[model samples]
Structure formats: structure tokens, C-alpha cells
Target: MKENVFYGKGMGPIKRDFPDIYEAIVELNDAVYTGKVIDYKTQKFIALAIAASNSDDRAVKKQIQSAINEFNATKDEIMDVLRIVLLTSGMPPFVKAVKILYEVME
Candidate 1:
């Protein structure tokens, strides 16, 4: 399987210490990201919005980076996603996500 951007700093230890669980998670991720109907880029944007709505700064940054690196997503595209976040999740998460987005862009 390709490297998963969702695997953060602890993944190496998890992969070494719990191979079965690691593989299960990777397989699940692959299955979910199949792009059968919704394209991967759109899926990623949805994921980004979810992360932002949850006020997860690290996840927001990671999603933004992954979208840009994997799909060449632009600031405008990210801003559009944040606009949805702002509407649905309110200002705190939206502001936090925007801050993380700018940091990632920089």
C-alpha cells in the first residue's frame, strides 16, 4: 500500500508493534478512498471540512497539505472549503482552520 498521509508520528511504532491492526486500518483507508463515485479530490475536500469542523488543528493542516501535494489544490479551493466550515461549524473552528491553512500554505 502507498504511504498514508493520515499516519502521523506514531504510525511507525504502531506498524511495528501491531501489524494486523495497522494493516487493517490501511486497508480500510484504501477501501474508503477508492474514488468509485466521489473523486479523491472531492473526498479530500470533504475530509478537510470535517477536520476543520472538529477543530483539529493538526488534522486540518495535514489535510490541506495532502490535498495540495496530492491534488494540486489551490488557496481558492481551500478557501471555498473553509467557507463551508464557517457556515456549518461557526467562527472558532473556521478561524482556527484558516490559520492552519495559511500556515500550511506558507
Candidate 2:
């Protein structure tokens, strides 16, 4: 219901211009973030991985910030997740993630 600064630039405008889509997105975020089986911290890592895999820099930074703010995620924890991204998604995404990782983790 409230504006999510976590969603990054342009999202507020999108919410105003396309409320239906935004609502659906919010619902999806709620569903995924509930962490029915995985637990919230683990889900945050997964979300971070997904963001990296997609090469969505905004989402990557958002997830990183959220995980750090909410879970107090450490640099090692973030690197661990990025390692998985590297192994599965290859080098480029992993490198990008590593760059953002340092930007946020410090």
C-alpha cells in the first residue's frame, strides 16, 4: 500500500500510471517474500541470485540493500550467493554482481 523506495527509480510513477500492474507486482512480491518453507534470509539470497541472473542492476542493488538492511547480511554471505551465480549463470553476471556486492557490502 505504501510506496516502496526499495523498488527503485521510476516505480512510483509506474504505480501511479499502472496501478493494476503494480498491484499484481506487489502481490507477487508478498507471495515470494513470505518464505513458506525456505525462511526469509535464504529467500533473500535466492532473490539476489535471481536479480543477478537477470542482469537487472536495479533489482540487484535493491535486493542487496534489502538483505543487508533486513538480515544484516555480511559480505561473505553476499559473495557466497554470487559464487552460485557464477557457477550456474557464468562469469559476466557474477562479475556484475560482485561489483554491486562491493558497492553495497562496504
Candidate 3:
């Protein structure tokens, strides 16, 4: 899949380079899947918001695009959550995320 492109390219090396960190990420993914904190779609949105708020462009774009592809989330819905992220996290993060999203779409 398009998302796998990054990992398949060269990111796998970095992931494997840090076994402990990679394991923690794997554990977190498992918890997120198994935990009942929210429904799958909502969880995806929350994760997208957090990534966007952290100004992690690659992560933000990946999660947002994944949600769109997997859950059929509309652009407006994604933007709404992004707006909330901006409110909670601040302008800088929001702006960075928006720029990344725009770049990805283009």
C-alpha cells in the first residue's frame, strides 16, 4: 500500500535499528487496537490529531490519509478534528500539519 512505501523504502532500517523503541511502538499499537478507549474510527482521529499537534508531518499525513482510505472520513471531518487540535495544541502545530496535509495532497 502507499503507506507501506515509506517503510518499504528505507524506514524499516531505522525501525529495526532501535529494537527497544520499535518494540514499544509495537506494544502501543497492540494496546490501541485491544483497548476500549474509543471506537476504531475515533481512535484514528485522535491519533491523527495528536500527530498533527506534535508537528509530526509524516505521521499526521499518514494517519489522516489512512483514516480517509480506511474509514471514508470526509475532508470536513478531518478538518474539524484538526481545528480542535489547533485549539488544544496551538497555532504552530496546526499550521505545520495543515501545510503537510496540503503538500501530501498536492
TM-score of each: 0.92, 0.82, 0.70
Candidate 1, residue 101: the lDDT equals 85
Tell me the lDDT of candidate 3. Answer: 0.74
Identify the runs in model 1 with alpha carbons over 4 angstroms from their true place.
Answer: 1-3
| TM-score-sorted candidate list, best first | 1, 2, 3
lDDT computed for candidate 2: 0.84
lDDT of 2 at 49: 98
Q: What is the lDDT of residue 103 in candidate 3?
A: 69
Judging by TM-score against the true structure, name the best candidate: 1
Best by lDDT: 1
Ranking according to lDDT, highest score first: 1, 2, 3
Candidates' C-alpha lDDT: 0.89, 0.84, 0.74
Cα lDDT of model 3 by residue, 56-92, tens digit:
8778888877877878777778888889988999999
Worst 10 residues of 1 by lDDT: 1-10
Backbone clash count for every predicted candidate, in the order shown: 0, 0, 0
Report the lDDT tens digits of candidate 1 across residue range 1-106.
Answer: 1236553778888899999989998899999988889888899999999999999888888889888988889999999999999999999999999999888888
Q: Candidates 1 and 3: which is better by TM-score?
A: 1
